[model samples]
Target: MKVQVNSIRAGNVIEYNGKLWVASKVQHISPGKGGAFVAIEAKALREGNKLQERFRSGETIERVHIDERECTYLFKDENGFTFMDKETFEQLVVGADVLDEDQSRWLQDGMEVTVSLYEGTPVGAELPKTVVLAVTEADAVVKGQTASSSYKPAIVEGGIRVMVPPHIGVGTRLVINTEEGTYMERAKD
Candidate 1:
């Protein structure tokens, strides 16, 4: 499907230069002397090559259609991460080459993920916007550092490091934003 370049967003797959690329980041820039344009950083789907391009807001681009399926993360082993289809109970073993390391690290047991399929082949998976993880390690709060804007480095479940409010400590359950890998707030449950 053809769409305005300005409409492109991160995670959307598009065909550029006869190759399929997934947009990793998108930024809209409007300089003082030039018309607005969308800057995109994309990674090749099959070969994993990366490309950065800029497109005028008025230009159109080819966007590839990908099928998204709801799947539950089963487990990980030598074959890579395995997920079960919620509807058919079919199992899919997505290799590391297909699933980026950043995306795979966020997977938790039984977590619901949206698997992106191109031509029935799994390409990428999207985790929930926020995940609840218990802090495994946190830096000690220094005296007089209780300012509201202060944040400390902490390691959460899965060994993901995030900057959290100073009040957060080991064993605290925190809600983390998966997109930016940042702390949101204390997990209520």
Candidate 2:
């Protein structure tokens, strides 16, 4: 289906130049001297080559139609990441090539995710916007570094590093933004 350039998002597959490409990143830029445009970083699905393209906000692009299945993350093994269909209860093994390391790290056992399948093959997965994780490691607060803008580097449940507030410490449960891999706020529970 053809959609406006602004509608494109990361993890969307599109047909460009007669080739299938998966968007890795999308950014909207409105410069002072030029019209607003959407910048896309995409990777070729078959050739594995990456290309960056910019499209005017008014332009439309072809977005590939894919089947979105609600699946629950089971585990990761030598084969790859495994997920079970929530409805059918059938399992599907998605290769590492489909989901990057960072995206895979956010997966928790039994977490519901939307797996995008093209022609019955897994192409990508979408994770929740936020997740709750416990801080496993954190740097010691520096003297006189208690400024409101100061942030400390910390490690979360999946060994992912994130910049957290100075008050956050080991064992602190934090709400993390999965998409950007950043600390959002302290978890209520």
Over the full model, what C-alpha lDDT does candidate 1 score relative to the true structure?
Answer: 0.90
Q: After aligning candidate 1 to the native by TM-score, how far in Å is the CA of 177 from where it should be?
A: 0.6
Model 2: weakest 10-residue lDDT segment is 140-149
Residue-level lDDT for 175 in candidate 1: 91
Error of 1 at 145 (Å): 1.2
Best by lDDT: 2
Error of 1 at 95 (Å): 2.0
Model 2, 24: alpha-carbon shift in Å? Answer: 1.2
lDDT per residue for candidate 2 within 3-96, as digits (tens), equals 9989999999999999999999999999999799999999888777899999999899999998999999999999889999999998999989
Q: What's model 1's TM-score?
A: 0.93
After the best TM-score superposition of candidate 1, give how far the Cα of residue 87 lies from its true spot, in angstroms. Answer: 0.6
Q: What tens-digit string does per-residue lDDT give for candidate 1 at 1-189?
A: 999998988888999999999898899999999799999999899899899999988899999999988999999999989999999999988888767787787889999998888998887787899999999999998888875588889999999999988888899999988888888889997
